[model samples]
Target: MLELDASAHPGGIALWGAVLAVYDTSSMPPEIGIHVHARSTREGDKQVDDTFDTVVVKLSPDEQATITGDTAINFYLSRFLNRDIKLLRCPHCDEAHLDAGYFAVRPHRRHMCQACGRQFNDSEKSISNPVSLLKRVHYDVPPVRAPRNLDVKQTSYPGGMQIWASNPALVWTSARAEEAGLHIHLYDSQGNIVVDDTFDHVEVDGIELNEVHVQYFMAQQALPHLSEKIVSLTCPRCDRPHFDTGDSAFFPHVEHTCEHCNEKFVSKGRRKLVVSNPFEAVRKSLRANWQSHRI
Candidate 1:
């Protein structure tokens, strides 16, 4: 039997506080269940006790090996909670699980593996190679607006170009920008086009940015852009919007904290809008196919 426990930190909802996972190997197939403890608070004085909710899954032999070997328990909890929870396991040793506390080192943001004593930098290459944890599951999701290919062209000025896309999320990466020539003149909803100097930065869900990247940006920057373009929910406490910005997994969950009030909330795995761009959709499909081939 393998058991895992997790609790939400202060300022987060009590329902997110308590989580438990149990996997029994003795059974022929294998029995697994995830339990979440929820509590309601009264406005006055009396406090309500905790109530339990559970999701049970039966596993095949291959799936059992996947649960025990490759994935972490938080991955399962993310599925149950329908929110993205960040969990790190050592890439070097592949055994030791690293928590937020493990990244306490400053300046370089380097991580030293406790199990293997391997030191590594927090770069795009390292962060992208997370251990696979979640299995395929079906869910009914809403459709997003389809992304039309932008007509990107070079301008007479050095490092200058013109581009237009219906999806605001479709921004060129540093490499793609350089490949197409820089100093882009973006086309607005109107037929008129303007340079970055003249273009107004769009603000969505309280986030304003001059540019967005397709990949290779830190979570801090990427999450905000994703929140604006993708599905988002407002905080019940402070009324600030929060976004889900985790990798594409079937019914993936993401945990979020409000910037204004510091209240925490979890996304319930339902996207109000999906990525409709063919480029992004194809990229996701290819990536999924590659990952499956690798596994």
Candidate 2:
């Protein structure tokens, strides 16, 4: 018998990763099973949908020799079918798979089937229902930990705000800001005050000020400060170190593309600053920003 566990981003058809465990019903031991961890991505050809790029196969050393060609093929076929790795066929014609690029455009609300020329909306209902070849195996993991030290500061200019952190682990929340005794405000490019309110929470992308969406815009403006303190990690694919900073740093489940090879990988663990004097670091950062403003 085969048991499959899978997970994906919300509204995303692509499966981020999946675990497939094969067990003999008669000899089912909680600890013993053929385990495979497959990580899926759409890195290379953007036109192509998700594909399994990395796979970690785990089996007992004793059972390793028992795996034959037929068994291997069956195992892999089951794994693929369980994870929904197949392309999505057009419901209208069932001839060609829908192009992700065309469907991704916001204005193209309804996707026209290339073969049938029938336009259909990829509605929430359609998205929720995927063609599954095998019974879904329910498996879930704890949510990723929120980044630490997501500090927000009211900017020198009225209605202007900035979010900063020493590392990429910082996740900003309205509650965290409030705890830090900070107030939320919106400002324009010209430093004109836009909105000043006492709101309980602020959705990064939901707030609009002066006809402009402020979702992560303010956080982006303040990212450079944190970038200076970013630590580098060696890319598993390229074997070259890449800086863990910029937009990729803050978001979860987002992969960082290597600058050299363009190989994309997610930062799994947290990297922290070993500051003997954190106060000095803060003062220096502030001083540097102050000097830059004058210049």
Candidate 3:
């Protein structure tokens, strides 16, 4: 088997490396089954959708492995969410980090210390968010593209709205980014041109227009559209992140409080996301609708 470089992302790699190093896989179970469960968070949903995949690795019965099936399952599950490597410490009873909250980024949403046997609770530990984790692992790595300085401004037109597309525009630059992938509506001030930017090209939405949204629109050519954005903010009280749903009553009003820190934030109103990539916006809309109704 080809070996993966262990030095990369030292913390996370080290843990997996240690597992691989300690596992004597020469003798192990031959038939291994993997069952992945898609958990639904809808109300009144108590069922899990299970998808199974099997791997047949030839091994001896006496072969010793550092990790077992259940442990391996947990290990793989950790990969779904990006974790910080630096926060992990000694898993041994001795020399282990004794904390109830996050020990490292690699193992996130931890409830207990595997090494020291401590129960994690709100008062004791600090939890990381998914966006932060993503930025840490992939965004912060060295020798990568530098962060762009984008000047984004939004304003209203007569009957629609206009959001200035920021630079490093993936839509224009990435060839792989299909036009259909665009989820956005461009309208002229007269509320005349309601262009639905679709995958291959833009289509007119009710409002008559000569063309879809051009790369540039005159200030006079914009429309007035309501904007509802979801923002995640850390609570001032407990410093835990909560999604701000804005203020709208027609949609579900969720009160987001940090389960650990008891920090409180309210996510009110309906979530309205306007995507310049029509495909993404439509897809997200479909998903949202499905989730809302399915639940």
Highest TM-score scorer: 1
Q: Residue 194 of model 3: what lDDT? A: 56
Angstrom error at residue 101, model 3: 11
Estimated TM-score for each candidate: 0.23, 0.21, 0.21
Q: Tell me which of candidates 1 and 2 scores higher on TM-score.
A: 1
Error of 1 at 174 (Å): 42
lDDT of 2 by residue, 1-295 (tens): 3222222211112122211211011111222122232222322221212223232222223211222222222233223223222334578777533332112111233456666777766543221112122222222322222332222322443223332121110111111111211123345446654543333233322221210112222222222333433334567897875543332433223356677799977655553431011222233444454445545
Ranking by lDDT: 2, 1, 3
Which ten-residue region of model 2 has the weakest summed lDDT?
166-175
lDDT of the structure predicted as candidate 2: 0.31
Q: What C-alpha lDDT does candidate 1 achieve relative to the native structure?
A: 0.30
Query: Candidate 2: where is the Cα deviation over 4 Å?
Result: 1-88, 91-93, 96-111, 114-116, 120-139, 150-295
Write down the worst ten-residue block by lDDT for model 3.
Answer: 16-25
Best lDDT goes to which candidate?
2
- Local error of candidate 2 at 91, Å? 5.4
lDDT of 3 by residue, 85-193 (tens): 2223333443323221112212334445565676444332343222121111122222322222222111322233222221111001111211212233344555464
